[model samples]
Target: MNRAALRLSARVREVLEEAARRPDRGDISTTTVIIWVAAVTGAVLIAGTIALVIAKYNGQLNNL
Candidate 1:
């Protein structure tokens, strides 16, 4: 290839490599983490409705 093409390709490769080294997007985002934690917690609560003592203890067990 020509010198100009090689130079452009090298710069583009350098930028891509630098970007790949940083893992800060999509699944690792703050909102995604919060949503994942909330979903898991909700699932646990729903699955363990009978064993959720805190919920009953906080309220009067008679409510259930």
Candidate 2:
């Protein structure tokens, strides 16, 4: 198992829990799940994009 990732995940969950404690924050209350979902989704998409870009350029280098 990846211990570093596990620790990160736990920290993220702890942050969300803290956010949940404040019901008066309009944005958080109205779109709590949406916030985190978007964050995680964006992170994944960004990482994938970086991987894809690197792979594409690396492939081109082989022909030079």
Please give the clash total of every predicted structure, in order.
Answer: 0, 0
Compared with the true structure, what per-residue lDDT tens digits does model 1 show for residues 1-64? 6999999999999888977997553447788889999999999988798577666696776679
lDDT of 2 by residue, 1-64 (tens): 6999999999999889988897556564548888989999999999999999989899787889
lDDT, model 2: 0.87
TM-score of 1: 0.38
Cα error of candidate 1 at position 6, Å: 35
Show where candidate 2 strays beyond 4 Å.
1-30, 59-64
lDDT of candidate model 1 versus the reference: 0.83
* TM-score per candidate, chains pooled: 0.38, 0.45
What C-alpha lDDT, on a 0 to 100 scale, does residue 32 get in candidate 1? 87
Score each candidate by Cα lDDT: 0.83, 0.87
